[model samples]
Target: MPHLQTVFAAVLLCGAAHAQNMIRGEYWIDQDLGFGANNSFALAQQPDVASIQLPISLNGFSPGVHTIGIRTIDASGHWSLTNFSTAVVTTEPEPPLLTRVEYFLDQDPGFGEGTEVWSGTGTDAPGIGSLPDVSALAPGSHTLFVRTIDSAGHWSLTVHAPIVITAPDVASDIVRVEVFNLTTANDPGFGSAAALTVTEPQINLVEAALWSDDPLSIAQGNTLAVRSMDSNGKWSLTNFFSADVVHTNVADLFTQTGITTYPNPFSEGITVRSEDGQPLRVVLYDPQGKLVHDKVLNGETYIDLGQHASGTYTAFFWKELERIHRVQLVKH
Candidate 1:
């Protein structure tokens, strides 16, 4: 007598007691086959049990065409029907392509004064996708917006990058900050719709950052101005700025993995490393490629390049034989 085995929730069971009368089982091969139906000689006999193995062999069947089925007849002559199984072949389609990439930068109020700063399609280079080189933005906290247009004439969701531009050597404390909404001429005074006052001011007021989660209406722009105010109620010269009013989530701006640099317009060396604390072989090349710097660093390793001249330089982070990341460092 063959032993009994059970299958529940897709798991096989063993060592089950079985004492009952024998029951006959059958299998159907035809697509239209129903209970108490199927091809001839495709039947097996078994005892009354919740689980049983009834194997049968069929010959002279055509290749690439066949459906196997099973059914069991209990001691009461009750038929437990089975579902037909068929092979389904599927070919995965390719994803939509982003034909182009455009970016906008909200720069310092005195420079790059506009909603749009730079736009271009990214290169095919891997790891270094079509991300923009924002070395031109002034040292301070700024917003970068990027979006893509698919080849199907469709537009994907706009993504934003919140970056802080800073210089390492020129560290300063921020005293007070102000915001200006230039979306319309209704407010020409460049007066802040928002402001923050600090008792101690940093060396550079430009390092102060201001943002609003509630974006203004379309066709609206904003400017930020910061200055050190005296206790006697006197205000310093206001450095006005303009920016795009777009709703953005700060979290989405950063990736789960990659290298990050700080002090955008860095005066000294900048910190570089993987998002997840890992070692990276760093390299630096001046615009003309005449000056080069290299090192292996880890999480938050502050690389002081203050000795280098104040200009734009390219930094590369290599993992093994591949250059995992790259960025343009703006040294002030």
Candidate 2:
């Protein structure tokens, strides 16, 4: 006879169409005790299909070799085939522990050449108390590689972490700032936009109203773009805000703008006629104020709208940075 050993029995049972609930289960070791006659056990609950974990006794037999079988019975009195498994019991051995950890920056100094961060007798070395100085390294990106050796002298795969070094900041002067139009025909181009006078190296707020002799046409949707220049003559990217209605001089909208759009209630597409043959940007927005189409046109250009849903949309015509005309369009 042997001391009783607890074996974890994972039992799974499939129910037949005539049977839905698994009602009981049993297990036997080494020899057959016939169905429903082996060591029976009670399940916590009855389910249509059963998957459960229970403990089976491994006693009254030698530890050298043994076989265990499990089965279940359903409400319809159908017994599942035995799930047989073999067990081999033996004494356990001691496990290895972590003995050392080493790390290197940028380059691999090779095995023992890396600075040792930890050395002790333990299963784990949690944290590194001391780190190498990085002040001498140049300002840029670098990688730190780390590895560990176990008590059995086995080295793990090297792991690395990326690091970035930031340099000290230098003062830059604010020479000038400018404002311009992006879609208007009178775009002064980059450094050519109207400059705003400034005397400080850094500024938080800017107060100035920029105007053009020939401004963007009076429309609901219009923008004025502005940017700043450093003393090094580098111009910042344009920042735009909605333009307020200052004054209005009604020009010949059709003749002066030199643009025309045909097929008012268009089905498939529409045509834009540019009389002066200059490049113009056309943008269309759907009823919910979503932009549906946008393109730059030169001479006479045809825009196909066959893919858009049937709805009323607003179209804005722009010459360079200036918006010259805006009209409502219907697609049927």
Specify the highest-lDDT model's number: 2
Every model's Cα RMSD, please?
A: 28.8, 19.7
- Report lDDT (Cα) of residue 81, candidate 1: 48
Query: What is candidate 1's CA lDDT for residue 1?
Result: 19
Q: Which stretches of candidate 1 lie over 4 Å from their true place?
A: 1-30, 34-46, 51-70, 73-92, 107-131, 167-332
Task: State each candidate's clash count.
Answer: 17, 7
Mind giving the per-residue lDDT tens digits that candidate 1 earns over 174-201?
Answer: 4444544344544434234445444355
Candidate 1 versus the native: TM-score? Answer: 0.27
| Tens digit of per-residue lDDT, candidate 2, span 1-332 | 34457778676655565635677888888888898889897755465655667776665556566888888787778887787777655444455688899988999988867888888988789778666667888999999888988888888899998988898765677677666545454667877766655645674312232222223233343556667777777766767765432221113435657677878788988888878897776677766777766666678989888888788877767663433466778889
Off by over 4 Å in 2: 1-86, 90-95, 116-121, 128-134, 139-141, 164-169, 181-189, 203-205, 208-223, 231-237, 241-332
